[model samples]
Target: MKYFKYTQYLYLVASILFLISVIVKIINQEEYGLQAIIAVGFAIMFFVRRRFVKKMENNKKNL
Candidate 1:
């Protein structure tokens, strides 16, 4: 449960990595549409998980 708080950041990190990969692929004149899509997905997941973690923490506090 304690780990859930930090795990959300991993998604952010993965998103960043995917974005970087997209940039690199662009520089090399390669297709990066899929990576770009996945990066956005991960970014969304990061935010969603962050909110969920905050909700969990608040619920714990209320308990």
Candidate 2:
């Protein structure tokens, strides 16, 4: 159901958000737990999206 072409844009947003989160955490130096959780969550999503995109591309090639 997911359109693979949009994954690149999704990653772009996620990466920017992740960078912002890291910067905020570094600047504030507080609540390390929440910041770490968010960072990890985004990282996992990025990998999942990457895999889904790759699968979609392979399927497209076959068809």
Residue 34 C-alpha lDDT in model 2: 67
The CA root-mean-square deviation of candidate 1, after full C-alpha superposition on the true structure, stands at: 0.7
* lDDT winner: 1
**Model 2 residue 14 lDDT score:** 73
Give a tens-digit lDDT track for model 1, residues 11-62.
Answer: 9999999999999999999999999999999999999999999999899999
lDDT of 2 by residue, 1-63 (tens): 566667656765776687687788788885556656666677777788787788878998999
- Range of the 10 consecutive residues with the lowest summed lDDT in candidate 1: 1-10
Candidate 2 deviant stretches above 4 angstroms:
1-3, 6-9, 12-29
Go through the candidates in order and give each one's C-alpha lDDT: 0.97, 0.72
TM-score of each: 0.94, 0.60
Which candidate tops TM-score? 1
TM-score for candidate 1, residues paired by index: 0.94
